[model samples]
Target: MDGTIAATSKTDARGKQKDKSPRLRKRSGFVFILPWFIGFLCFTAGPMLFSLVMSFMNWDYMQNMTFVGFANYVKAFTQDPFFFPSIRRTLHFTAFAVPIQVVLGILIANLFNKKLKGKKVFRALVYLPCVLSGAIYGLVWNNMLNTDFGVFNYFIQALGGEKVEWLADPKITIWALIMTAIWAAGMPMILFLGAMQNIPDHYYEAAEIDGAGGFRQFFSITLPMITPTILFVIILQLISSFTVMAQVLALTGGGPAKATYLYSLLVYENAFKYMKMGYASALSWIMFLIVMGITIVLFLSSRKWVYYEEKGGNI
Candidate 1:
């Protein structure tokens, strides 16, 4: 009876140990991510909450705090003349730049995916621009796109075309910015390349066996498989384009008649330069809402097109 009791106690202890193992693993995982959670709460969440509250109050470093309700928001829309134009310009830049970046990224990625000579060198050249500082790139392009005596103009003159005022003319400045954006398409290209390489070789092999040509195989197999990556790249590029400021500030400084005045630059001017903190906060919240709305729409639409292998095709 003593031996049987000892054996029963050992069995219960073993079962308890087995139950605690999963709990231990979960606790360890949470512990590993605790720092990130704490940082997010302290830095990100804290600032966002503070900014939300400030948006409704007339806040300035030099002035007394006054609760203004939605007056700040109303002033942004009705009183500020630069507000709507900035939004339009930002949207225009996004519209042109994102599509071009997506296309160029896909093409460059496809090129890199091919088995060719000097492939590593080509890949490095393509990715090199992504590492360059945005401000530095803007400065370099600003000089390059100079109306007279710039390399671009020299080439145009050699070809008997007129010297184009790239950054100086309001009509052409936005396009110049868009061109600069296209040049920095390296990140999305690298992402696309990674996604393409992850696709199983067996799929392409099977397509070849089915007498599908290269173009047909790409359209039917490669594209469908890479739709998820495309969606991710689009959303990321969209957000970046909308929030673009450094390049615009460096190159055009909101430019030849505020033609290139992005929404971000406008917000910065109001907050720091103009000392209109409340208005800036309102603008920031508006931008937040716009970005969130677009992202939500993208996510909802992605369910129809974004393919996932685990979901048997799309989710």
Candidate 2:
């Protein structure tokens, strides 16, 4: 009976150990991610919350915070002169740039995927802009787009055309930025190449066996397979285009006029340059809502286009 009682106690201890093991694992995982969690809360979430609060207030860095209750937001929509133009310019850039980049990426990826000589070198050459310093690229392009003695205008002159004001004219400045963006379209192409490589060879083989030509195969098989990647690239480009400021700052500094003054640059100017923190916060929130809304629409519409193999091609 004493031996039996000792066995029962041992079994109970074993069961207790099993219970504590899961708790210990949970604690260990929390401890492992504690640094990231703390950093997120302190840096990302904390600042976002603070910014949200500040959006409703009238506080500069050196002043008392007075809660104005949507005054900043209302002012941004109704009174601010830059608000609509900035949004319109940013959206205009996005509308043009994203589609061009997407198509260019697809074409480059297709070219890179083909079994051609010196393909690796071509890939690296195309992707160089993506990895190279953006500031350097901006400086180089800034000079290249100069009205006189610039490579682009020199070529145009060689063709007996006029030297265009690529950067100076407000009418042409936005297009110049668009051209710069397209020049760096190689990253998305590389991404699409990755997506393209993942597509099963059997699909292509079957299409060929069915007498489908190159265009037919691409339209029916390749494109369908890469729709998910296309969606991802579009979303990424959308966000990037909307928040583009540093490159614009380096190149045009919002232009010969405010023609290239994007929405994000407007926010930065208000926050840091003009010291209108509250107003800037309102602009930031508006930009966030715009992006979030567009992203949501994309996602909701993605069910029709974004093919997920894991879902067995079902929405």
Candidate 3:
């Protein structure tokens, strides 16, 4: 009888320990994460909620705080003259810059993957631009693209070609910004390289055994295998291109007759330059919605193209 009682107590204790273990672990995890959670509530979530509330008001960075409901949103859609133009400019940048960045990144990654002398040095140089601050990058490129005594113009002049106003020309300023964007394709290049390295060598061997050439192997094996990485790069580049700000602010200041005036510039100008804080908040939410919409579309469309090797199917 005593033995049976002791056994029951042991079982109950074990059960209690099992239940308490997870609770204790959960408590520790919460304790560890408390700092970040508090920070998010205090700084990020608080500010975001504040901005969302301000979007419905008519606060002009001063004493005014009249609630105007959907007036700001309606104004952005219909009354603001720069709205469509800025949206167009931002999308134009996205269309051109994202593809070029993806292409350049892939090509550079492929080149660096090959066995070559000083490959490590070359890789470092290519990724150098990504580590640079946006303002510094703009300042560097500003000098490089200058028509008078700039490196680009110096080369053109050397080849008996006329100096082209890369930034000063309204038509060319957007292209110049796109050029800077292309130069910053280093992060995607690194990502592509990592993805390419992860591809199984046996697939390439099988392709070679079937009498496939280099291009055939790349297209049939490498490109298909890396479609997942390509999708990731595309989404990242799209987001970056759409929300581009510091480079334009430092380089042209949306100058040359507002040719490079992007959507982000409009939001910034309204918020700080013009002191339309409420309107700027509305614009910000609109930008978030646009980006969220595009991201959703990309994710939905990815089912068609993104390949998962482990799953042996498209994502």
Q: In what order do the candidates fall by TM-score, top score first? A: 2, 3, 1
> Per-residue alpha-carbon lDDT of model 3 for 1-315, expressed as tens digits?
456555545555686756546654444456556679999999999989999999999998878799999999999999999999999999999999999988888888888887778988888899998898999888888999998878988998999999999989999999899888988889899999898888888988888899999888878877888898898899888888888998998888898899999999999999999999999999999998999899899889988988875657554
Model 2 segments more than 4 A misplaced = 1-20, 310-315
Worst 10 residues of 3 by lDDT: 20-29
**Candidate 2 lDDT for residue 126:** 93
Query: How many Å off is the CA of 95 in candidate 3?
Result: 0.8
Clash totals for all candidate models = 0, 0, 0
Report lDDT (CA) for all predictions: 0.87, 0.88, 0.88
Cα RMSD for predicted model 3: 6.4
Candidate 1 residue pairs in clash (backbone atoms < 3 Å): none
Name the weakest run of 10 consecutive residues (lDDT summed) in model 2. Answer: 20-29
Question: How do the residues 1-315 of candidate 1 rate in per-residue lDDT, one tens digit apiece?
Answer: 456555545555675756655554554456556789999999999988988988999977698989999999999889889999999999999999999999899988888898889977888898898788889888898899999767889999999999999988999999899989998788889899999999899998998999999899878987888898998999999999989987888899998999999999999999999888887988999999999899899889988988877758453
